[model samples]
Target chain A: MDKLRQHIEDITALSDEEYAYIKTFFTAKKVRKGQYLLSEGDDARYEYLVLSGIYKVFYIDEQGREFILQFAKENWWMSDYEAFFREKKATVFIECIDAGEVLVNTLQTREKLATEFHKMEHFYRAKLTNGYIALQQRIKLLLSSTPQERYETFSKMYPDLGQRLPKKIIAEYLGVSRETLSRLYSR
Target chain B: MDKLRQHIEDITALSDEEYAYIKTFFTAKKVRKGQYLLSEGDDARYEYLVLSGIYKVFYIDEQGREFILQFAKENWWMSDYEAFFREKKATVFIECIDAGEVLVNTLQTREKLATEFHKMEHFYRAKLTNGYIALQQRIKLLLSSTPQERYETFSKMYPDLGQRLPKKIIAEYLGVSRETLSRLYSR
Candidate 1:
């Protein structure tokens, strides 16, 4: 919970009372590696804030092929946001990659917190601004960049994630074949 | 500025005084067809809220091939958001496809408005939330869907955009060849 306090404080200060109230909106959950927090067809009822672990948000296509949408690490937020925001059934799965705990909150809690606290609303807006920029960059890479350029950009942007994630998963994220990834890796 | 007022009021009600102050932060510009609002290497200082007309946000790669990122219509916001938010040089171009008017504001103006008005903050946050979801859906389409599925989903989600945009532009946006797009259209 202290980490949660620090995370919010990084953007805006909160009184002890406010922090206490905000903490109540979130419940702690421990997830082990290979465990799924969310799966397709389930209700995406809660969004998770990573405390100390890694998770991948992804969807499997008709042919059972997986496409990684995002990776959430410590302090990052994860959910099938399109489903979560629209209060729809999940089309994506959030699976734990490393054993750790996360703080989960429902959409009602998120809105209630933001509505009750202006600072919290600002914090959320700031976070969304950064997320929007990241997705824009991702779209640009998807639309324009070559395999080699993509690999280099991904490595530069997420060197820690590169070290932590498996090569196969990294290859999928970069939209490159395993052979191509291996060639790039050797280079 | 009635459109701007209505756009914000759709999310939250604002007092006349608040609207007056808010409108002052934005300046209106009329864009002629084929004119560029932003281009690569230019300073992306302001974000635009479309009043009337159509605009395409895109980039040209090293091979001189164009990739369309998004099309903005009336009431839509368009910018090189990554650059606009970070105060960096634009990496994308925004050009008017059909003559239209837009309200433009700088990051400083946006931050000031949000800081001074809680409702404005909420409005911006709501817009970002929607944009974020749209981008997520786009990533899903790009990563997992077949070309046909992508085209169908796109047509379903944006029937107006589909009708307004040319087949070649739609093909580029969907990452399909012109022949593939034409075949899909005929089907």
Candidate 2:
């Protein structure tokens, strides 16, 4: 609950009574490495805020290739957002990369909190604003950057993720091969 | 302002009084073809909502190659959002392809409107949510799709944009050449 309060307060202040009410909407769960938090065609009913460890949100192509959308870390949120927001089946999968914990809440909780508290709405808006900016940067990089530039940009953007994850995973995220990542690393 | 009302009401309802107050924050501007609404290094202090016209939001690389971030059509909004939200100088250019009109608003106006009305906050959050989903799909397409597949997907996703835009620009958007796009069109 302290972590939740801290995360929310990072963007907007919440009174003690408000924080108490907000805490009731979230449920915490422990995750195991290699566990699937969400899978394609599942309900996609909930989004999780990482308390500890790492998770990757991705989708598998027709050829069974995985395209990583995002790697969520502590205080970060992850979900098949399109599905979650639309109340549809999950289109992407969220897999735990490291065993840890997450605070989970359903879309109902999100809407409820947002409706009940203007600060919560503002908090959500701020988070989305940052997420939108990051995604736009990703698009800009994809449109123009070379593999070397991609590696450098990714490293600069998510130094923590780059250090924690294997080169193979980084390559997938960069749309390059593991050997290519190895070469880049050496350079 | 009717169009603005319609657009906002599509997401959340607003009273006549609220619409009157909201409309005061936006200014109408006529755009000419070949005009630059925003350019790299300029202050991107405002976002434009297209009344009617086509504009390309893009950036040029060191090699003088252009990468388009998005096309703005009627009811669409465009800006160097990273700069717009962060109050930084523009890192991209927005050039008008077709002459038309737009309703413009500043970040301060946006904040004021959202803070004044809960429905306005909901309206903005909903728009950002959709934009987030759209950007995520773009990333997924960039991650795995081939040029041909990109063309098809682009067409499927934005049929109006495909129909309205020239093949050369579409090729640029798909990260392919005009000849490649022509070949795809034939197929």
lDDT of 1 at B121: 92
Deviating ranges (above 4 Å) for candidate 1 = none
Model 2: DockQ score: 0.90
Top candidate on DockQ is 2
Question: Model 2: per-residue lDDT, tens digit, B1-187?
Answer: 4899999999988878888989999999999999999999999999999999899988899999877888889998889999999999999999999999999999999999889998888888998999999999889888898998898899898898898898998877877778988987787
Q: Give the chain A TM-score for each candidate.
A: 0.97, 0.97
Positional deviation of residue B181's Cα in model 1 after best superposition, in angstroms: 2.3
Q: Which TM-score value belongs to model 2?
A: 0.98
Pairs that collide in candidate 1 are none
Q: Clashing residue pairs, candidate 2?
A: none
Q: Can you give the DockQ of every candidate in the order shown?
A: 0.83, 0.90
Off by over 4 Å in 2: none
TM-scores for every predicted model: 0.95, 0.98
